[model samples]
Target: MIENIPLLVTNISYGVTFIITVGFGLAVYLKSSRKTAHIMFLFLSLAIGIFQICHVFGINVVDGESSRSIFTGSLSVIFVICFTIHWVLAVLEKDSEKIKTIVGFYTVAVGLVVFYLINPSAFLLNSVPKLYLPNYYEAGNYYWLMFVFFTVGALYAFYTLAHAYRIADPAHKNKLRYFMAAIAIGFPLGSTAFFLALNINIDPIYSTLFSIYIIPLAYGTLRYDVMDIKVVTKKAVSYALIIAGIGFFIAGINWADTLIQSVYTWVPIWAIPLTSSILAVFIGGFVWEKMRDIDILKYEFVTVVTHKFRTPLTRIKWASEMLKKLIPVESADQSRLAVDEIDNANGLLVELTDMLVSLRQVDDINYLYSFEESDMCKIVEKAARNMNKHILDKKIDFSLVCADNIPSVMLDARRMQFALQIVIENAVIYTPEEGRVSVSVTQENGKVVVSIIDTGIGISKEDIDHIFTKFFRSKEAKTTDTEGMGIGLFMAHQIIERHDGDMSVSSDGIGHGSMFKIEVPKA
Candidate 1:
């Protein structure tokens, strides 16, 4: 057995560290902060990760140690050079000088790679006595040049950090100090690994200190909120829990396997399914975290995009109103119709913008809500009035039946109005012409219940379950109204849930109509 315990342990540490650094980079990218410096650092992490993996393989994969070590060692050195240049670029502001330096560095890196490929013996000797693995390469004449290149690149990166620190604003000084300190401590410790190539045979484990390089980045993330990257702390803790659980479960599997083999006559077939289920949980947690992160970015994006679109919409509405006032009374009916259409279009755009903004705020726990004791009957009446035009146009018999002495509920009036409006309007849209759309409010089970029943295309059993999911449109609804964005019920559900209320829908299959009931606590 190749019993190099220390080397094996070092490889394992490298593997774990690589996983961490790479995961952090991916999480940052997934957050959609999209800062250039963040991307550069991610690239730096990736390069080092490749190096660590290669190093592990060099030590463990014995059959091709000679060639593998040389290639991995050489490739790792190149990556170090690449990261060094990228690090400098990340710190410095972009300019003509920066571009020139980048181009020059790229040229030099390419030249060095070509030189190494053509005459690798000048940098690494192919033949050497086996150490712990197989035959390994030794430092050669050109090796100093490669070392000098890495040393220069690293020094420049540190120099850039120091320079940035000196001239930075006082507010930024502490953050830069943290970064400078991390690079100062981490790089030197990691650099000692280069000595191993020179036959110095120093303790190689210090090489893993590269992982410490991320300490400052993480500090920057939490302390300065650097790169505008926001990481939910609880999510991070959850990830830690997930990782620990996976480790514990893996250990348990091994222990169980051993116990079964030793103590029992045969292994149980059920063990495989049990192991798979545990693994599925671990995988599911990881995927769930990713989905949640993406959802955050999605909401932020929605907010920005809707805000941009809202500006033009506001201008259009204002301009159309102004034009209407300027038009003479004797103007043709066509002109009036065109002006009316513009006003209608502008209203739709305004409503859509508001809906997008509200949806974006749905996931935020600290979302502002002005709650007060408001009459539930008055709220529902106002919502029903807002949809009176649509109900009338459809010739639907829409009635608001509110019980006398209906108690007030503590709620955000505007949001509650919006929620109720959505429910009522959806009822008007889906109900067939001349169908009945009735809204009722009453106290039930110590809570105020608002129910909207529509005699129109009903929801199927399968569709009812998913009706409240964002952007989910039932087949019936899609055919009935192709323009529906399918967010009304979703927004209504979110608003009600936030108001300490419950929203549910029931239907007796398609063509039988549906009922939406919302129950909020009475004040």
Candidate 2:
């Protein structure tokens, strides 16, 4: 029993590694499969899981079969390296064509290595029982080639990440640093298995702890917003506590079953599992209902608070208007300026109140919307005119173009104008002084298409997908507009979707520009 302890511990390490790698990979993939980085991570995780499984079985298999099992597992390393490169490039937002070209070359090379690995004789001589691992394989003629391939590929990935980190912005640099640290710890330690293959006789204690890197990797990815994963802290903690409770419950059942069996030997074995299953269902349903109730309460609280804000905002607006009227045009410039400041402050407060109301309505299932046929050009023009003050303040080169034959669209006129204003406002706020903002209204494919383009701090590829997500703000966006709530686009998108229209945005990356297109069906 004592002699088997090392094998047991090693197997446990592999098992834990497999669970964590696959779990995170699946979680990320399920969250956003369209992202190339997520997909590559999933593939890489499966490769690692397969390798671990093979090793787990290889260590327990007969000596004659052990070599084949371990060697077959070795084939997965090629895929691991290939997918790692792809994942890194994707995360770094490398040029798509360049990523394809580089990853394609590695893929072809991996295919060749996979074919070579199939004939184990090309890379493995034989297997021998070792101190830590149950079976350690001896290197054959071309085994060095495997090491070379892995080393070269891993080094290249590390180099790329290091280079990116050096020149990356503050936010991106932190994420890259986390990734680099994780791989730096995981790869080198895990590669100790290669030393064993070369018959160096070193025990792979480091391999047993290789999965430790996942801690930093997961933290960086989730906490730093590496991908567009929106993790609600409350939900995550609640679920974690629930899962822990269930685990404790299961253990308690087992303990009780053992105690009962000791006291009454005739009790049927099926009773414990059956009783536990029923109790689990009951508890799960109870927890789910409670969670739903909590959501309802949260929404209700927000609704009440949002409604309460309207009264003060209206009074402020009225007071500001009165002040503006009381101040004569021929009076001191300071008096006029003071009134203007008050009006501006009031306007900002009103806009915030409106945004809050809209946010509340978005969560209200029974909120009614009035839809009518409204001229798209007029709506666009109105939104632009409303932002004229901002345009003049920034000295922006703003232009509006309306097609002569533009069609009217079915929309809630007030909501649609609000949505348009949100998009136009973002354009004005984000663009630097003297930058250009253009709005065009035209009819295309039986739909009214409104395009708003701006020269601003453009959205990154990663952020563009999540720009419309509630409370999601890009690093640059946050820096550019410190007072932005990050909900305008989200509310606007929701409003447009309710009108059976579509909203989309494109950017040529940061410091370039952005284009937002809204399409609504013609009435």
Candidate 3:
């Protein structure tokens, strides 16, 4: 009704472009890449989108009652100013906060224009909607304030883009040159339509129609992997397909009713349930792609478990051979030497076995802890005895001190001992040669406390943040000669947490040593 048949196609194109602008802009903003870049892009997209929406608005927005087309004319002028400023800021990588301030100013300016349009009788800006072709065609207010906002937006954008282009990176300059060219050509051509709409009695539809030239630049922005619009289209198609299928079935049922109204008048009611069931079945079946691949975890699992089994089994074999050679030994010193060596090798085998056993435990989300009513002193002594060979070999000065009032605790004996062994082994592995590693247990404020303090190459600030994270090692430890599979601390954290105990780290950065304080409930 507003123009030739071409205007109808142009209106649809505007709808698509506006939707794309909003969707792409939102993805970039939420993604963790560049907060400044994505946020500026969002502002630019929103401004352009507001203008596009107004260009397609009809008198029916007010139910054909309002005389003035406030949306069509006013929003168009404001869109030019806001869109240009945002586009320039986005291109230049301007300070995000400063650009946001400009956005607030532009929004306030545009709102004033729209406010004056509806209340021309009581304001500085006048509202006037002129009819060029009777009820079929109409044009809205020619407010001067509205045009001022538009000119300001255009000039701001021009300056923004020009300043940004001069400082762009070499890689960015080449890829962005086309988008720059598009802006150079598109904004001027688009702005010309706004100026013409103000003074002349020309068809206003061509203004929106000419704005489609900016799509080339939009495509460039979206295709650069910065915008994740592909994911949106994937979901959108699924919704459309489902709706189309239901619509077809409904149409078929209505046809059946009319064809046999006398014979089967109740067919439409039955079609409702059938349509719902079809939709339910389709959606339930379509979510397989959204499920995680799981292959990455599976690959890491095989690698970890394989190394865990091999290390301990090799130690056990060598330990067994040493015990055989020790039978009917030559000297008193040789026999003592053989026994200590055998203890060291067997200790490694037990640790390796515990390490393997932990892999299976980790897969079980909930395993009841085999809590035994145990003496606090005995638990500490058993752990110390199990780790004696490691202490002597690493020359770590280990000690245990239990308070007189330290209550007996309900603990899983083997698991708790295994937990202590892991922390001790790690401390020995990392501590500088001859640097002391001490294990002490005591009761404090009605809680069992186990402290393992080591003068080791300490954790860095960044490493401590993710030290308990799976398969992660401190950068210093990774670079050092320390041989670790990176699973000991993770398993220890899980075991401690399962027992309602807590573990924490205290480090003075790099060369400064670390301390682990473990606190669990005492029975």
Candidate 4:
């Protein structure tokens, strides 16, 4: 046992440092605002972290050789399987091919798990406890087959990423580059531990090389926002805590189960109950925090919806009162005015209800609008005209520039018009009185571009990033218009994207003005 001290220390230090770095990476990943490709990455990190903890325990803490072998064999295979899945997903966009890859990986993962359980010794043979840190293992016949499978998977992943990098759009290419660079350098350097499987007796010195991957991973997450993951604050913290809980549980379960042969040899019976009580407190706190977060989000959604409802209800009440008073007057003009007022109020109520319903079920749109191939320039013109009231009220200098012979596009005309109207209305609302708002449409390279430029209180740099997020209102916009629900841009952005187009915003700075740009493929 004395001879194993250095090995114990080395494995403990390596395992602890690796886990901590992975934990930090998980935190950064959870903070992302757009979680597209991030779910796979999260699972990969989690698997590696689990494998490390189990590996360290197998080497230094577990009493029996078979127990240690069982732990390492099961976890190592799982780690490789997750890495393979993450690799395929990170490179491919969501498509039928991606589904195939997922299915293939899952099959392989399940097979490996079954094989390891049936006979862990088949994958992990006799282990030689040594004075040196690296242990010697007798090679199993199936070991090389697993090694070759992983090697091929890693190579295929690199090739797929390279091919994707060559064909990706300019906006996405840089993200692929960052991911590729990290994987290329990190995975091989970290895979050095596999040498032990061949009875090669390689030290775990290169184990920490796995941590280097976190550097580029973080840079991509923070600098490029590559994965487009949205991590709400409360949810992120809760998930982080839960993941940590899981990690502790996995590491502690075996120790607790085989308490007599392991660390519990020195402990008294009373200590077990004390430890259990402490764990219960932690579990209780995690559950309570998650519940509180859910409650907060629910409260916020209800409050905003209630406020929006009140505006239209107030207008309807006023219209009803007017109709009641005018019934006795017997004047045609007064009756006509009351009828028009009621009609307008009903329209507003319908609009508000549709908006809320659409938001709730954004994926379904059959009731929203009819789709057809139509002149996009005409749509832009109509949308701009609908916002004429707000524009004239603000007395803003506005111009609409349209290129001749513009191409037609497939769209739900009324929905697209409503989307564009929302943007233009926002431009008018945010602009100061007498400020300029420019609406321009042009055809370029098989796409039609519509831009709305406004010299208003511009969005702050930080706010511009989240401008299209649901229920997000910038501080500057809030001061200007308290009645705005901050969902207009979100709705508009969603509509534009649903039509296979894109919408983006740019601003120089506050007081410097801003621009909302849209692009759609021509029909």
- Candidate No. with top TM-score: 4
Error of 2 at 405 (Å): 22
Runs of candidate 4 with Cα error greater than 4 angstroms are 1-36, 62-64, 72-94, 108-119, 134-139, 211-215, 218-238, 241-305, 308-313, 316-382, 389-418, 422-491, 494-523
Candidate 4 lDDT over residue span 383-425, tens digit each: 7876665677789999999988888898988778878988888
Best-fitting candidate, scored by lDDT: 2
Indicate whether candidate 1 or candidate 3 has the larger TM-score. Answer: 1
- Model 4 quality (TM-score): 0.63
Candidate 2 residue 319 Cα shift, in angstroms, is 29
Q: Sort every candidate by lDDT, greatest first.
A: 2, 1, 4, 3
Window of ten residues with lowest summed lDDT in model 4 = 224-233
lDDT of 3 by residue, 275-373 (tens): 656765665465433432343465468667767777866777677677767665555565666665676567656665665655545444463668987
Runs in model 2 lying further than 4 Å from the true structure = 99-104, 224-423, 426-469, 472-486, 489-523
Candidate 1 regions with alpha-carbon error over 4 angstroms: 31-33, 64-70, 127-137, 226-523
Give the whole-model CA lDDT for all candidates, comma-separated.
0.71, 0.76, 0.60, 0.68
Alpha-carbon deviation at 25 in model 4, angstroms = 7.4
Clashes of each: 0, 0, 1, 9
Worst 10 residues of 2 by lDDT: 224-233
Candidate 3: segments with Cα more than 4 A from true spot: 1-267, 282-366
RMSD of 2: 10.0
